[model samples]
Target: MALAIFDLDNTLLGGDSDHLWGEFIVEQRIVDPAVYKERNDAFFNDYLAGRLDIQIYLSFCLQPLAEHSAEQLVAWHAQFMREKIEPIMLPAARELIRKHRDAGDTLMIITATNRFITAPIARAFGIDILLATECEKADGRYTGHSTDIPCFRDGKVTRLDRWMLENSQSLDDSWFYSDSINDLPLLSLVDHPVAVDPDDKLRAHAEANGWQVLSLR
Candidate 1:
């Protein structure tokens, strides 16, 4: 059995989703531009450092769109991601995924980007299964909150472990690619821990540990 898991942000694409989401918020006029800048700066900064709390960030991100119909918000998000980010996806990355798919490997995209944003992107590639952070729903509408599982770093390792167990698969020969050292938990859990354009922490770790480091960016 083959499992090739990929990280969504920089490994697959060249940018950060949180930064783009803030731009979307401004373009959509979902929030007062002045106020959004203040909060967005802090949120984005914390997120990069792996200190941002999912529930708080999810609440703030969804707060402005709260008044809009969920369907409309989701549609707009899908369009923005497709139009802005999808076109920028690197060909090499696509080719890598395509090769894996052709080989009949199970493709799993594991990302810190929330379900509201990443789900549609995954669906675009016919990826039905995902591991993403979810915003809570109350009466079929977003409550501007996160659910119990926060899909980042260690949480990713935990969730993937459960997935492997449920599928009766072992991590012995599976492949995983990620950029940040924050993903070390999940990376270490796999037999193949690939560092894709790794951050400094991961770069040093890969060097020290003799892990195969792939820099395609």
Candidate 2:
């Protein structure tokens, strides 16, 4: 079967999940807003500009996971899904995924966000396979560190290739829909690269390459 990979942030949802998660933490007083809110904004801006330091960003993003128990995290995430994610779930994006599902495509969401944050969100969209940056665990608790590639920029291509090998699949008849220029590596590898509500750099790149540009907003 062919692949249909999706990016989770602004590509599918109306807002950035990682950024919104940070904001949610601040709003819930889970993290000290004074300390983390500014850094979160800065990291998000860096991401948009394609200048994010993945290690630094991941440290800030995953530390909370290490601090909280798995049960607490599940409870928090359930609340997060209700308050932040569901409201932003665009009908157009859902319909797009549905169309691909109806076509019998193998659907997945490959995101730079860590699995802890994006996994349930992917499932909410009925996607089972999520290739996201993995947070390392020790003794059933998070270590606040990634065990493998960050799955950002070029790492996405690397991770995808490895997943393809393990699954006996190929990108020969695949499609990827994303918004950021950071996804260009995997976007180029796919047979059909669709820029969904892409940033300026990605829009220009898509136009130059004759890739399809879609506005999911």
Candidate 3:
């Protein structure tokens, strides 16, 4: 079976979902503006530079989930989806996903963003399988910690390999669409690699490798 995997942030949307999620929380007054806003900006910048420390970043991002009940998060996320995520949906990205889906490919969104932030976004795109950074829970609340290696950089390949093993799938007939140099491991692993609005390094690598480069935006 053909497997089609997509990176969620800049690849599928017009912007970064994780950064937008931080902005949404700050705008909603869910986090302390005095503290979180600056940190959020720094983290986003770090991510763009491909220097994000996932553990430290997740500690900040997931803390809000831990402070609120699941019900509250669900309601707040519904609002977040309406106010932020929906507007950034790229039409071409949706069409590409649809094309793959219509071809009976096993479709998935694999993102470094946490599940709490990305699951709904994946659903909005009509994708059922999302491999994202796992948030640990305890006593029906978030622990503000990741339970497994984040689905990021080389870790994306690790998570994808485990998923393939569990589902009896293989990358031999897979296609991966991504925008970051960080995803090089999985991009190299897949039979068909597409760089969608890729970063400078990734674009250079894609060109060097003769991979298809596209712009969803």
Candidate 2 displacement at residue 71 in angstroms:
0.9
TM-score of 2: 0.98
lDDT of 3 by residue, 37-121 (tens): 8999999989888899988998888888889999999999999899889999999999999999899999999999999999999
Model 1 residue 12 distance off true place after TM-score fit, in angstroms: 0.8
Among residues 3 or more apart in sequence or in different chains, the pairs in candidate 2 whose N, CA or C atoms overlap within 3 Å are: none
Q: Which consecutive 10 residues in model 3 have the weakest lDDT in total?
A: 164-173
Candidates ranked by TM-score: 2, 3, 1
RMSD to the true structure for each prediction, in A, is: 1.8, 0.8, 0.9
Cand. 2 Cα-lDDT: 0.94
Error of 1 at 155 (Å): 0.8
Better of 2 and 3 by lDDT: 2
Native-referenced Cα lDDT, model 1 = 0.80
Candidate 1 residue lDDT tens string, 1-217? 6898988887877776656877777776777888897888888878667678766787788665556678888778877877667875767788888888898888999988878877877776556678988778788787777776778888998888888899887776889988888888888878889999888888899989999998656
**Model 2, 106-191: lDDT tens per residue?**
99999999998899999899999999999999999998888899989999999999999999999978999999999999999999
Worst 10 residues of 2 by lDDT: 143-152
- Model 2 lDDT at residue 29: 97
Question: Candidate 3's error at 84, in angstroms?
Answer: 0.4
